[model samples]
Target chain A: MGRIYLGVDGGGTGCRAAFWDTEGRRLGTGLAGPANLTTDFDAGIANVRAAIAAAARDAGLSDDDARGAVCHAGLAGVQSPQTAARAAAALPCTRARVDEDRGIVIAGALGPQGDGTVLAIGTGSFAGRRQDGAVRSVGGWGLRLGDCASGAWLGRAALSATLEAADGMRDPSPLTDALLARMGGTPQGLVAFAATAQPADLGALAPEVMRAAADGDATARGIVAEGAAWMERALAALGHAADDPLCLTGGLGPLYRAALDRDGRRFVPPLGTPLDGALILARAYAEG
Target chain B: MGRIYLGVDGGGTGCRAAFWDTEGRRLGTGLAGPANLTTDFDAGIANVRAAIAAAARDAGLSDDDARGAVCHAGLAGVQSPQTAARAAAALPCTRARVDEDRGIVIAGALGPQGDGTVLAIGTGSFAGRRQDGAVRSVGGWGLRLGDCASGAWLGRAALSATLEAADGMRDPSPLTDALLARMGGTPQGLVAFAATAQPADLGALAPEVMRAAADGDATARGIVAEGAAWMERALAALGHAADDPLCLTGGLGPLYRAALDRDGRRFVPPLGTPLDGALILARAYAEG
Candidate 1:
């Protein structure tokens, strides 16, 4: 049988897998629950396998065919060399490689030979640049320490502003009212919600803030503006040059596109998704 | 036996109980684990009982004597009327009253009849003012939404700054180096630490930041200045008058006292501890 390659992108919220033939023709894709290896290594491995199996099935491949495929997995929380090595060795595939998820974004947004910056704004945020096959990153310190322009950060900012309005530290506005209503109509309710919320749970509220901003709520608009400003700062810190190709990727990326000042910067469409980048690596490994 | 009164000061970190007789003579004091009602109602009730039992034992009181004692509990996370009612009903006293922890701070810092503001800066931070038997407050929304000048806030700010320095977003300073060393000398180690850290756990790092600030670390100094500014804002929002008696209370209170601009504000020492305030209330209930 011809060689089949599997690409996996695993993150805090979920995992995705894509299958492609040796000629780079897409076969199918599948998704599963959170696969952050540091949080649950066994669960991450399980989900990665589940996604790959589903993708293979979707592509009309038998179980044996799926097991024979070479895989490349780009995973979050693979920071340490030990974790990367362990993850690679534990994969279900006969031949596989593990890399940091950030690398996939760089390869996806800017191709392997491409050089520039990718501002990934999602449930979490990260900024990265690639030059001469080397990648450097800033931010993505998780939702607590950083992730400045991320959906999680935006939601957290909105919640703080809403509570501030409730406390009269800031003026009450439509945004605060909407947020309070959504959170059961009281500042105390918001407190209860925040007490147990995970980063993604908090990030789920980003849409509410975005909606309010779209409707011209001052507080919401201010939050979006602040987030955009932070993004600009992150881009600058990542050494993004004016003429260098820049791609904004991830769920919140499109929302922030208009807010960001793109003057003198070459805003380019991403060459491919992280999954596609993972497939590129898988293909290379299978050929080798 | 003379009437015995118990004052309980319960919070997120720990619980304190002070026993006194009707004549205002202190008998003994005891401490127990965290007793934030909403977070862990059963644990809070148990801790409160344990603290009172310990105090009673220390004062050479029998179980019956402890059961007959009037108790006043000032507890954190007693937000809603239902929680207050439930907490009051669950206490191990013949007669009892439940009040927000913030109220106890006001009474402790400014006496029952005194009218002014109290800036309680501990693992958390709160600002409250009492006037004509009514109390108004600003901030103290917990580590997530508010608590701007709190130890948790300070620690979190320091951590973020440390990460920023590590990422080259900010200049490396002694403060960042110290923080990294404490967390295992790596950014990834800090990330792991933060992933599992509770609010009190983060608050424990505040002293490190304070120490660095005292040693002239620019990042640490900036964090302290920012925290102090937040305190000033919180006090003002609590309707603090120019000449109002302003008292800083809590573990970190004295440390922040020197940093806060007390211009035109009447700075005063707290008349007693929260347990003292609780005892006063218990005494009133027992006598009445």
Candidate 2:
């Protein structure tokens, strides 16, 4: 039987799995609910398994074929060695490797021999650099302590600025009024919404901020600029040189391109999706 | 039956109930668990009731006497009029007035007629000013939106700065090291801790930051300065004048005094505790 490779990108919001043949041809893909290991380890494992099974089914593969597949999962919340080991052990595949989601993001953006950095700004944000066959990352500290320049941060900043405007701390803007209206048309409503909002919930508002920024709203423009500044700081921390190739990935990444100071730097396109990077790892494991 | 007044200071950490006669003589006091209305309405109501029951028991009063007592409750998370009305209705008192916890704090610190500002910096932070029988407030937007100089904000800032130091984005300090050590001695550990940390849990770390600041830790000092700056912004927004009397209250309030720029303002001592304020309100209600 030919070797089957499975790649999984498990994040706080959802999980996606891709299946491929030994020849590097894509077979099928599947998606499931959130799979952040730290938030819910059991649910994460279950979702990963479910995604793999669904991918196999979509590819017309038997149950045995799915079980025999070699898997590489780039998962959120795999921060520590213990968590990585635990996640690896929990996978249904006989041969599976678990790593931080940022690694797959870097690989998918830059490929095997590519040098430079990738700044991923999605529901969460992280910057990764590949040098000397090793990957180093900065700022994927989740929504609380870090994830600066992330969609979550952008939305949070907008909400806070809107409240400030409401309280006359800052100039009122159409953007703030629109945001408040969406949050039940009152500052108290926004406060209520913020109390129970998760990272993804906040990130969902990022597109609105971007829309307002594009329309020249001062508060929105300020938020986007601040986020871009944080991204620049992250890129610098990742040791990106002036001429280094950089790729911005994730949902809110492209929105930041114009805002970022790209002087003397090359903003390259991503080689593939994180799923592709996961597949590459899976294939390597299957070959061995 | 004599007119009995009950005052309840309900907070995120715990609820305190003080019983007094109409003439303002203290009868008894009781303590119970957290009673933040928004977080858990039923639990808050139950705790308030339990605290009152205990207070009456300590004062050698019957259940009927406690049930007939006029009460005033100052609770956390009574942000909107609807929540306040709901809370008032749920209270086990003949005549109850429910208000935002900050009002009681202002009353306790400045007295009913004392004009000026009060900065309450506990697990949550809020600034309020009393003028002409009305109270105006700013920056009690909770842990997510505002609460700038709050203990929760302080702990969160320390954790974030510690992570930046760990990532080489900033210089490491003893304060960060000690904080990291408490959270399993690693950045990963800190991330894990942050995922599930509630406001009160984060607020618990504020004293450590204060201690480190006093010991001359640069990171700790930065966090303190930032908090003080936020307080200043909040105070300014509250329209505090140079001559206005300002009183700082709450667990982390006094720690901020040395960091704050008084700018020729009179810093006064709190007239009484929140319980005292609640009792005063209860007396007013009873008299009317």
Candidate 3:
């Protein structure tokens, strides 16, 4: 019967939910299966509901109380406002808000009221800033158009460079040679793969490029440098100040963090995880 | 009725058929609507049939005679051997061979027995050569993967440069400014366009980029120079010798020819049309 808050963060990997009472003390948490809404809406929504239920059970709240709880969810594949609104309508909680998983990273990494920036670059890329309780973002345009500095973008660039090398436009290198070998030793092989490759499929190659760059492969180094340059440009375009507290997140986040730091970018470590940000949002919304 | 050759050249724009007798005397020629077999297979086939019928009528040959004549078709969108086979099977001709449109460009430009190289950079790109009755090719990978020096590739690179400029990674220039303005004055607008753009849609922008380059726009110049460089590399990769009969063909072909010629490339003019190449192939196949 008392005020309760539910915070849910869902991505391709899995879903996490945190429950807390009105006093801002955590009651319990629950984990669930992968919940990428865009790829599998039914499964994602189901997993989301299941995670909330488990969190409620762990918190000793009745099913009805849990359903009545104020909730906030940050999920992957929430591309449009319609998706967000639909997700909110689908949730069990009576008072619920749904948002792209990215938004929560800002609060999670920079604290609920922090004024700084966050760069989330994995299979996709975007830069965000929360200032004066307002949030603005740039560059979540997906791999086909943009998503510069993202894992998918990096992978695509590497593959492109490999093909260019094969065509003698670029100097062949160890990385290009290795990539060519892996892609069936011909440009056709890469072409066949690219014909049906999704963003994640492309992003799958980012680690290799990064690893090769670390080992001083000229081609890989150039790729990484270009990605790093894009990141810097993104930050600047986001109006990031030299002294702003920057937090990098996502799978390729750490690699870029190092690159940016080495390039004189002074970044601050995240205060918490996205789940924490969700919980913070849940509490803030309920309290308001 | 003794021996007649039918050469069909089918593309996105239109289809042409040339009919010839044993001594290589031209019988007649016919034109029809767009016959790009890949995009509109039924229409393409219908148009091809219609064109051949018209040519037969012009040559004073019966439909049966035309169908029995040895035939060769060079068509756009013949990406695979299977498509070629399928096209060959579907044509009305009794003895027919099907090949990608690019192949015929070599014969058309270099003559039936001419040993030479050809670089065709239109909405898509490919480099090809015919020597000693054998044809070899490279770099027809398409816009998504590797259409080096193609119009689509140029447009994509220009758009990418525009986005990079918007992000502060690349220096903003007149070309980028004009592109941004034309594309709704925002990176998001470009992203929106790219989200659903086909190769042709992207290639549609190539003319503007080329024009800008011709007018001394720095970003446009860089894009064109890059495309020109790819042309050189592709020619070299295809084993083009200093004295090889190089022919530049396609919508963007002349633009690149100018660039390549300025860069010391000596290109030969087409000795015939794709229809001629097809007719030549028909004769070769039937005689043997």
Candidate 4:
């Protein structure tokens, strides 16, 4: 019997879903608004369902076909039973499973039978490993508490660099000029901009921090260097997991790779999309 | 007429006001609600007024006498013209002055003409210096962006150590027990606590970080050592002012001092209360 499958990577910024077949071929992918339970529990569930529906449409499949599909969601904010319940209530299917985003990211990086480790970075960050086929993870403490070397960290570093420039402690930075332009040329404007700014918004400037460092902004360089140090700290916390085949993902992963001076077996996932991980997860469930 | 003066310290957790005379004799003092500008501007102003009014009443001053008194406030959110104006409008005095809490703190530490430097370390932290009668500052970029080595930083470090302990990346910490007890035994509970927790609240447990260090929690030792380093960094930055007689105040000041390993040239102010600085400023204006 032909079967459909759905995979999702749910994070603070949004819920992303992908549709797949039993052979691990991705048919379609979709993006919806944020699905992190900490911010909006009910809305997060709605977003997951909507993202699945949209991906099915993109795959030219009907709701009935989608309903028959098995689904797996790699989600942030699953640290609690309430979050899991909220997600389970939203996605109706033949079978639905939820795990931490770390699991999905690792599955994508290492594959079903692949024995390795992965660090997922975007709005948040964490390292996951499959050692002797038992999965364990570290880091990814969420934005306010941890998630070091993640996009949020990069964004916060950019803001710190800009503020240092305004405070006259750091020499002028290229990122400062770019940030000021985006913030309308005043420190007060910058403050207002940062009042509602998120990790992704700041992560968007990770490239700018990199560019400024290249152009000799000592402070910007320091910020990125500090960021690199934080990443190292996280990696250190991973212990033996660092020796595993380490894969990097998210907005900051590629940008920070050159800056990371470490002795580890490293590889970049080829697909350039987390949706591929979702599809693989989906296909595995379909095959089972 | 023996003139009365009002002194206010508007901080993150609350606002405090006291009434005193030119002779440095405290007449009365009162405490009120939170006064942080980033979160609660209106409440801050109201709290300041409420504290002052209560102080006046306790000092046995009539409404007319209070209205004629000189008032000086060191406020948390006086950074904005709008907030400063709101504060000035609220004080029931002809000569009402509002300044950054840091400025007032320095003034309080040194007396009005007692020129020097100060490290204010309450819920937040910053270093301020006055040289040749000009004010210069280091750190205190505010809680979210900067204020490294402050109470908030200490608290965040404690939390990080707790998580590291949970993951077994570091040796178990006394801070782990303190934090686990404080956090109600879960990571999710800890996040919820952190959402509303302040720096001083965390700094209160700085001893745990120090104790954990002594007990060989590498993570905790690292936190205290890093705090010392950050303090050194702030001192180095403030070195640009090229002044003498640095003072340290705020909640973490006394706690972090011996760990700092700095010289006696950096004086701890004799006065216990920051209100003395407000009194000093009021007296200076009175003399002028």
Candidate 5:
């Protein structure tokens, strides 16, 4: 009954919270709406608050006790240390820390001090390696400039090919035809959709490309192959060694891992969810 | 002294006006500020009027005469026929016509009825063919959707490569080095610049790539070669024939033409400027 730990896992889609007693026992977990700080800092904070409250209630802790809990968060859109500090300051706990959601994901996948790489590719993509307690990352600059091999990237590539095909520049394929039909059967309609689409909206089309590629659609297959090649190159750039533990995390991570060749790398399962990663960081902070 | 023709060529950078008499004599010409109707309709109209007024003054015509002058316009951002009609209705002339700037460029290059293709590449890009007085076009969908082979496209590609190189996903070269230094000396700097930069702002970097390519920079050479290849495909998609007259127009047009192979292609000089094409259309309308 000395103290409690609250771990927050925040992302573009939603916020989740878990409670753990100081004795290393999991108490309860809660979920709430999106908490992507970069795109919606206010909403992110609000959701994080709601998720924490729910977790505290589920753990049967008093409101005051919940407020006194030690907390650490791995959050999306923590583009700078200042933003992470701002997030920590905005939280309810007396001692709260925040880091990038990707970092937490990597930590959770490979453990606090595990040496390996995490290829996290959901709505966004980033390849991160934790080596000898050192962490480094690649990509994840967002859709305008980077984020290659991400869901948004795949969807955008399909849409681009569809437009080029519609313009008669490329051969029309089943994938392009189906995509154009879904996008209002006109290039202008697709263009209108893309003109104001957020990252999630574009990433939303990933399933269609994936499904089509699985079914052997030529265009979709090409896009996915190109993405796989990009992933290999990015991973290589991060100095991914042949014997390193490769844990593919995030919504699209497993899919990519399956598609990638396995001869040179050692594939491993994630030890825990991102929340567990956040919880591990929380425990580390308390110990320090 | 029967009827005077006013040809207005409006684009993102500025507007120009030219006058011609029934006797086929060149009257005068005028220039004004930016007049891209798509992005700034009111400003476009104002600039068009200013340009027309100056041309009328140069042709020794009064305000009433200028208002009475028959006008035809080839303007940037006229995306649809409805937009074209709206532009004509907003003009001072009782009889006015408006069309996509690329159309008039093609008309000007091929003399309205001359069968040929025009590869117009500037801040924007489009491939158009005039066949037996009928016209068809491809790939003018704008920066987000299309606009391949354009100045903006080239700049964006170079920046993308620079970011990849910075991340160590690809090898760095002199071209990427110089470009990264110019773009605030970092990937984040380039990203921030691109986040809000307009098409012209991005296109402003095209000359750098062109100059670098000329100086044997591998990255710059690759970008230009890619652009040239896109042009060839788009032109071919528009049914460019082996013996068809190919006239390159716009700021980046001739640069691409030079890079492309001349085999199976007939290169020709443009008959006149876009203003001349607008004037030709105006004359045809008055005669009918």
Candidate 6:
């Protein structure tokens, strides 16, 4: 059987799994249903296994070959240490490793040194640092507590700003008109639409905020600037770990790259997807 | 038919209605199911109606007398002006007035002179100032945008502080044990519990945070202090609005009173329940 390594990035939206050789060559890629461990643990693990199996099948590898491979899964909702072990146990692999999904992304971004900062800003915003075989993180306090400068934060801010404009407390901005149109021209409609809204749903409106800013909407611009400011705070919090290369990943990273690239901070893009970081960890354990 | 005025405070937990006479004497009160417009607009309206009908029935007022009297409602999830109008139109009264529940609380606290501030801290937190027939509000941006110092905010902060403690970056506090116990004593259990947890559900732990602070848990104290500081910032944002008596209401108020009062800021308890404010408004309109 051919030797393979598997990596998985389990997020709220979907599960992504990838297979690679020890030499860092990709062999297969797989995608599956949403696998946020917090929401559906068993289902997440199942989707993860199914994704890995599908990837192996796509690579024309037998079950035995896949079984021989080590796997690393980066997952969310593993806030508790006990869940870490359970999450590791849930994956269908002879050898597996698991941690907070952001940690995996940071590992990938920092490579072998793994001693810098990484900001993951998809659904929520979190900055993680790797130091001396230990990791520290900041700012994933969820949607209710913090999540500022996060996608969810940006969207909710945009909506409130729009409402403020509508109420005449502030001047009308293009973002307001656009968001109102999106929410069916009524705050009540917006409230109803938000019943099922997720962090990404709010984050998705980030571009509109950016677009409005580009078009000279002072309020929208200010919101984007505020998001950048928050990212700055997250990175600064990671300063406790060490001062090294800071990597930026996720959908909003590119949007705020220029702002991040300020203050002599080195914001490098990740060398590998989060899943690859998982694979690297698994292979490290297997070889040891 | 005897004239009877009605006031309603419709929120996430349920609707509270109070009926009073033109002489400012409370006649009856009633309660019903959750009526937060953000969650269930129709149900919210229904709950208000149910509470009012019960209050009227208990007051021995005929439908004709109830219809003749003025009604005032303070509601949540009624942000946009158009939505406010729609919500106002839905209530079962001949003359009805509607505003954000927080607004009425502020109005009740400040009255006609309109020089004070009020903090509405429950599942959410917001501050408002009454100034010459105008209201200036700060925060209360919901779980997504702002809501710092609120029950939801405290609970979320408690979790983050707990996680930081668990990770050894911060000191252990009462919140850690309380949160762990709440999460079923296992990490996986915590994640599972939080996966389905509502913001209000997390808010239930806010009182424990207060208790911990009172017991001199540094972490809990720090969290409460932060909430106070946020409230201060919110109050400051009101600028001229904070020139008079500042009122603190909601579940967290009494607990944090000493800490907040230390600023020498004139603090006042809400004049009455929010429904009383509604009733006050109703009586004013009735007399006019």
Tell me how large the interface RMSD of candidate 3 is: 3.2
| Candidate 6: clashing pairs of residues | none
Predicted model with the maximum TM-score: 1
Better of 1 and 2 by lDDT: 2
Q: Give a tens-digit lDDT track for model 1, residues A1-288.
A: 788888899988789998888788878888998888888899998998888878887888887777778988999888888888899888767788898798787778887576888889888888898876678988887988888878888888899988888887777788898788888888888888887888888788888788888888899899999888877777777777889888888887877777875678678888988988888778766766
Assess the local accuracy of residue B4 in candidate 1 as a C-alpha lDDT between 0 and 100.
81
Q: How well is candidate 5 docked (DockQ)?
A: 0.65
Worst lDDT 10-window in candidate 5 chain A:
A256-265
For residue B222, model 5's alpha carbon misses the true position, in angstroms, by 2.2
Give one digit per residue, the lDDT tens place, for model 6 in B27-111. Answer: 8888898887866788888888899889888888778777777888888777777767888788777888877787567656666
Model 2, span A7-65: residue lDDT tens: 99998778999888888888999898888887789998899888887888789888778
Instruction: List ranges where model 6 is wrong by over 4 Å.
Output: A21-24, A75-104, A112-117, A127-150, A153-195, A207-245, A253-269, B75-117, B131-141, B168-194, B208-243, B254-269
Q: Give stretches of model 1 more than 4 Å off.
A: A1-4, A60-70, A92-94, A283-288, B1-4, B60-70, B283-288
Query: Candidate 6 at residue A287, lDDT?
Result: 77
Off by over 4 Å in 2: A1-5, A19-23, A28-34, A53-71, A82-95, A283-288, B1-4, B57-70, B89-94, B286-288
> What docking grade does candidate 6 earn?
incorrect
lDDT-wise, the better of 2 and 3 is 2
The docking quality of candidate 1, as DockQ, is 0.66
Residue clash pairs of candidate 5: none
**How well is each residue in A135-238 modelled by candidate 6, as lDDT tens digits?**
77776756654566777877888887765554444566777888878788865555556667877777788777767776778888888888888776666655
Model 3: CAPRI class: acceptable
Among incorrect, acceptable, medium and high, the docking class of model 4 is acceptable
For candidate 5, lDDT tens digit of each residue in A249-271? 77887877657867777889889
Tens-digit per-residue lDDT, B1-288, candidate 5: 578888989988899998888876889999999887768898898998899888888989877777777888988878678888998998878888888787778778788576889888889988889898788998888888689879999888888889988888898998888878987887767777888888888899898888888888888899899889888898789888888888888898887666876777788888988888888888877776
Candidate 4 stretches greater than 4 Å from native: A25-31, A56-64, A81-86, A131-133, A168-172, A176-192, A233-244, A261-266, A286-288, B22-24, B177-186, B196-204, B210-217, B240-243, B263-266
Enumerate residue pairs that collide in model 3.
Answer: B109-B270
lDDT of each: 0.84, 0.85, 0.83, 0.72, 0.85, 0.74
lDDT of 2: 0.85
What is the lDDT, from 0 to 100, of the residue A49 in candidate 2? 82
Flag the better candidate by TM-score, 1 or 3: 1
Q: Taking chain A by itself, what TM-score does each prediction score?
A: 0.90, 0.93, 0.90, 0.83, 0.93, 0.89
Checking candidate 4 for backbone clashes, the offending pairs are A155-A202, B108-B277
